[model samples]
Each structure stands twice: as C-alpha cells, then as structure tokens.
Target: LENTEFNLLSMMYDVANILAFKAEEKGLELSCFIDPYIDPFVIGDPLRIRQVLINLTNNSLKFTEKGEVSIRGTLKEDLGNRFSLWFSVRDTGIGIPEEKLDKIFESFSQADTSTTRRFGGTGLRLSISRTLVEMMGGSLSVSSVEGKWSEFKFFIYLEKQASDSVSRKDIDIDLSTKNILIVDDNKTNRDILRQQLLKWKCKVVEAESGKAALAKMREAVDSMSPFNLAIVDLQMPAMDGLDFGRLVKSDDDLKSTILVLLSSVTNKGEIDTSKNIGSSRYLSKPLKQSDLYNCLMAMFYRESKSEKILETVSEPTGIIDGVKILLTEDNLINQKVAVKILEKSHHKVACANNGEEAVKMLEADHYDLVLMDCQMPVMDGYEATKLIRSKPEISAIPIIALTASALKGDREKCIEAGMDDYLTKPLKREELNMMLSKWANKKHKQ
Candidate 1:
C-alpha cells in the first residue's frame, strides 16, 4: 500500500504514464516537465495531491486526440514566506471557450455532448481536484481555447518542513459559543442546514418563517443570549430575503450580527438590495460544505483569514429564485417533456428548440440551470453549450445535457463544453426531480 504522508514524484509520473498511454491510443503525444530545483519534501497528504494530478492529467489525455498533452510543475519564490508551486497540464485538444472556463471547476461539468460521446467520464475530476487543492491551501485554475487547446493550472503553498514536525492532530473548530439562527420555511431545508451547522459544532436555532425569525431574535435577546449570525432564505411566505435582511439590519441589537441571504433566484437587483441591507454575505442554495465553511470562516476570522475564507464561498448572489433553468432540445416533444417535469415542481423553466435558440436565450436572460439536447435543427446542444459558456454573463449557469445519445464519451463532451450536469434522453421524472430538488434545495440553503 502507498503511504499517505509523502509527496512522491514517482507516483505522479506513473499517473502521467497511464494518461500518456491513453493519449497514444488516440495518436496523441504526452509529455511532462518538472523543475529540478523544486523542493521534493512538502507538507501535504500525498494521496490527495496525487489524486489531483491524476485527475488533471487524465482529463487532458481524454480530450486531446491528435496533439500533445504536457504536464509541468514550477516553484515560485516570490510568495514571501509561503512557497507557491504552480502545476499545469496542457492539452492540444479542442480548447475550452473563454466564457465556459469559469464553470470547468464546478462539479459534474462537461464541455458538450460530442466530447462526452468521444470520451467517457463523469467530468467530476476538476471539481474534486479543486476541493483537494483548497484543503491543501492551494487553488486550481484553467485556460483554454475553443478548438486549439486547454490548460489546467493550480497553485499550492508548501511549508518548508517535514510532515512529522507538524502537528497532525485535528483542530477543534467550534461555533457552539456563538448562536446561529436559521430561517427557512421548508422543513427539509431547515433540517439540512441544521445538520451541516451541527457538524461544525454550532449551537443551532431554527425559524420557519420571517415572523418566527424576528420572534426568535427578540426571545434570544430577552434570554440574554443573542444570535451571532442569521441565515435567511429568499422567496419565503411572509418575509423574503430582502425584507428579512432589512428588518435585521435596521434593528440596533441585531444589526451587528452577520446576515446571509439564501436564494434560488439569479436576480441581480435582489442581491444588490441584500447588500445594501448590511448583509455581510449572500449564499446561493444547493449549499456546498466548502462554501458554507468558507463563509463562516470569513465571518469569524474577519481581518486575518479573509482571503483564505472567501475563496471557498462564491459571490453569494446569482442564484435562481424561481428555479431559473435553460432547456435545450430540437424535438418539440422532448422540450415539452422536460418542461413538464420541471413545472411539476413549480419551477420556472426556459426552452430552446435548437442550440442556436439556447445560445440566444442564455444571452438574453440569466438562468440558474440549463437542460440541453444533443441533436437540434440550427445548432446542436454541444455547439450551443460551448457558445453559451464562452459568454461571461451566462457562463456560470449550470448546464445539464438532455440528450438521447448515450455513448461513452458523450457525457465527457458535455462536461468539456462546460456543462455542469447531464441527463439521458427519454427523460425520467424521478431523475429530473431528484436533480432539481437537490440543487434547488441547495440554493435555498445558501
């Protein structure tokens, strides 16, 4: 068995070799360039770093067919006390478009159906890689072209010391002394939030409505133990995120407490209003653990841990409130089927009969998620998604491939086009509902 503590270059080379073999199968050249002066002994979990490198290299090999795939590592000395190392995997395959570049690190994202069909993979490598990098005090990034090539780059800080000298004991991160109030009408949403907060060893309180939240605030003050932070949901029954934030900010006693607005709407105006109401931050629902942890760290650590903390949380806005969705498909029947599935959940849905329409719609409106079809009249889902992601305004919208094509690489292609998620053709209600529910609920919690 491999040791978990050491950062082994040999293992990294082995992974590169495996990917190189895969690349050669498609007549692609693969190579690696490692800086000789770089420190070989760095503090980190070797297994996790290896996992990140393997995933990135594998992705490069999977996408490149006719050209070379290169992996390189270089150390930067200008990082002050921190030793910053940059690692990149370059591929001469079809590069990613500029707009879709941001979503590449998001989970389940793929470029398009064509890429997915040609290469079979879940498109989760980058997201997983990003998570691993962050845990090791680093960041992962990418640069790409539409048809030329793509490059995945990451930077990590390595403490110049032996692993044994560093304390490996788990740190007790407690939020129990500080009160946390959760405002969400949905019981399921409240439960999930509570569970996650509890994992952080927080003392959690729940509010089912805006009125209840206010009452709880009053009760907490009266009881001589007030909340340190309030997590409020938008688009609720009585008071929405904006109104609730306004109320909390206006109150002298509660104004100082951090307010986090959670929503499923990508309405920019609403987000601005929340900012004006003294909300420290906004979180989109379908809340990821990393995002939540980062927000909390920012709040508590404030000045000292700002950069490290905020990196984990997204901008906290641009979430879809009424279930902002993009529907892509050429067949009218399939579009209707998809719409019916979403509408049943009372989610607002948008439709594109062809890839061109999908692109146009994406340009016109901000969607929380997109459902794309493989085949279409004017433009196909692959081309449309690729184009949509190439645009800055709509690039981050989660694009789910809705196609009849079930080939091996089709999923990978969808991810390669910067699509966030995927669903097979002859859509099933249960599957769609599960996805919508999971993501929508996450938005609600944020």
Candidate 2:
C-alpha cells in the first residue's frame, strides 16, 4: 500500500524482481536475503532509497551473464536513540579493477570505453546513488576483485518513526520570479534542469548550443532585462562554457550575471579555466537536484541587498500550445503512452509506426519535431535517421531518439546516426517537454 510504512524489504523485493527479470533474460540467477527485523520505517525519502537499490541491482545484472547476483540488508547496529541500517548488493559478474573502483563512483566515469560499448548508461547511477545516500545521512561504498566479483554496501542512519506519515510538501521551496538559463547540448539534460528549476517557481529559459546562449543574453540585454543565472554546459558545438563565460565576463553589461558551468569532464585543468572566467560555480553533468539547490541557495544568500529577489522554478505540468510533433514508434502501447503524454502538453502530434513510415511522412509533411524509437521493424531508428540526414531539405529537422536500451555507446551511436537528442524509455513527461521546448526555441531562432 502507498500509505504503509516504507519498508526496505519491499523495496529490495522490487529490485530483486527487476534483477530477476534481467537475469532470466540473460540466463542467470538473482536472489535476496533481507532481514525482516530491519527497521521498515525511517524519517526519509523511500523512493530515492529505492532508486539507489535498483541502480545497484541493475548494475549487477548488466555485468553478470552466467553467475548469480545476491542482495542482503540487515540492521548494522543501533546507536542509542538512533539506528544505522546496512544493505549490500553482491554480484558474480566481471569484477571492477581495483584501480578503477573509486573512479566508477564519479559521474560519467566507467571502467573503460568497452564498458560503455557493451552496457548503455550515462554512467550516472552510482554518482546519483552516492549523492542520495549522503543527503539522507548515509554512506555508500564498493569493493571488487578483478576477474572475480564485486560488492556494494551502504549504511543510512534513521530515526524510528511511530507512523507512516510523511509529506514532501514540507520540503517545497518558494522560487518566484527568478530567471534561470539552462544550457546543454543534450535536450534531456536541459529538460531535467528545467523541470527541477521550475519546481522552485523560477522562470526558465533554454539554449541548446553555447552560441545560442550568448545570443539569448544579448537579446535579454536588448530588452533591458537579463537572466539572474546561467547554467551553461562545458561541452557544446560552436562554443563551450569556458569561451562563453569569457565572452560574458568581457561584456560590461552582462558581467553581473552568475555563471554556473556544467561538464562531464573531470580534468582539473579544464575546471581551472572555467574558474578563471569568474564563474560563480562549477557543476558536473548529470546534475543532482540537491547540489544544484544548495548552489542556488548559497548564491541567493550571498547576493547584495539591492539585488532582485529570486524565485524558485517549478515543473510545468502541462504542454505548451501550438507545437507539432511526430512520434516514430513501432510498438502500439509505447506509441499510445507517448502520444497521450504529448497530447497532455497540448502538442499536435503525428504518428509513424516504423522508420519507413516516419520517412514517408516527413517527405509529405513537415512536423516540428520527431521522437524516433530506436529499435523498430521495417527500418531501425539509426538507419532511418541517417536517411533523413542524407536528404538536403529535411536534414535540419531535429530528431530525438527514444530508447529502452541503456547500454554504453548508445548515446554516441544515436548522435552519430543523426539524432539531435535522446531519452531513455519509460519516458518522463518533464524530460520530453524540456527537449521539445529546447529544440522548438532553436527552431524559432532559425
């Protein structure tokens, strides 16, 4: 039941089922040993904790093909009035190299390119898990032996609760009238950023390319108003955050805007360059909500009394009006669900059940955007996209790949095949809208 105590066992069971399905598909075994006595209630976010467990279990399944993946959770200890809970997920998969074990927890850091080639992910799960665990006053750690297996363990301290009543409304932030700019080449990243910012009631603007971001700033200045902060991506075509920031700082009028550079690059030299441009903060890509929130809070608190009051941006629940979209999917259920979501956002949508249909439809009519399902009958997304790109007339049309696969090299493959962006399956409405809005804005500028 939704209102029942947030039991770790139930969450583990869910993870076990997911792993079991994955194992079954790959011909492996998945099991769990969860202690029934482990505190089923904690004054914390259960959904987030579940995400951590699922991520670990999913990782286990990804690496293991013939061996078993086992999960165990128990009461580590109770320290007087407070209690510590520990959970371990172990796998008889390819063990991580000892040298690379620590790096795996870093955002976008995988053991090797081959890992990405074989398994699809942004390599963001573990990093997100670490952040989530820490936010809940917990610690997550990992151990592995090369050519053997691996184990991931985490401990969280929780106060015993008498009732299963908790409300996230208490954590809601008030962000009204704050102007925030999100800059990322990836539409999904922009979407996630926009949705999270909007939740705080902030006014959100998006730029897909760094060149466009500079143009946006100029437009804002021309209108006699500028954004409060710019969340710029470090990697983009035409221009990057370092160069963009330098340009911003060089302009006397735009110098006042706070610059927050985002990147997946962990090289210290690159970070130093960003800092030299007078950026207020630097955030790594696959942004975390808590870290972003903290940075915003710190920025607001440090601002001068004469500065404008900041508003929190909230997630937009409905779709923007008048946008036309093409849905390229072979699966009827997927098409229905995706179209229903797009319709809720007020977008006029056209459907193509396969890549050939999508191509044929594109030839006859112009759709504002295309959501191409990667794997399809008749013509797969990659081939279809390449075909679209080869055409001189329709080459500029933005096409985003909707994929269920999260293996490494997937995003790169999509991009190489001519997709402008991508979203992993079980699509979130906010991410979809963000991608649409971002490309739509680009189309408007063109």
User: Model 1: which ten-residue window has the lowest total lDDT?
Assistant: 310-319
Residue ranges of candidate 2 with Cα displaced over 4 Å: 1-5, 80-82, 114-122, 163-446
What lDDT does each candidate get? 0.67, 0.71
Clashing residue pairs in all predictions, respectively, total 42, 26
TM-score to true structure, per model: 0.37, 0.39
- Please report the candidate that would top lDDT against the real structure: 2
Q: Per-residue CA lDDT of candidate 1, range 362-396, in tens? A: 77776666777777778887778656544434544
Off by over 4 Å in 1: 1-172, 303-446
lDDT of 2 by residue, 1-446 (tens): 01223444344554454344345556554556544344444444554565567667777777876666777777889875557888888888888888898798997788878877886543556776787677667899999987679999999776665533441111246667678888877665676577667767888999998788888888888997798899987767788888889999999988889999876523335877788889989875334444577678778765553122212111223335767788999888888899998888788899998999999999999777899999998899998987775454455567889999888667656764656678999888888888887565434321
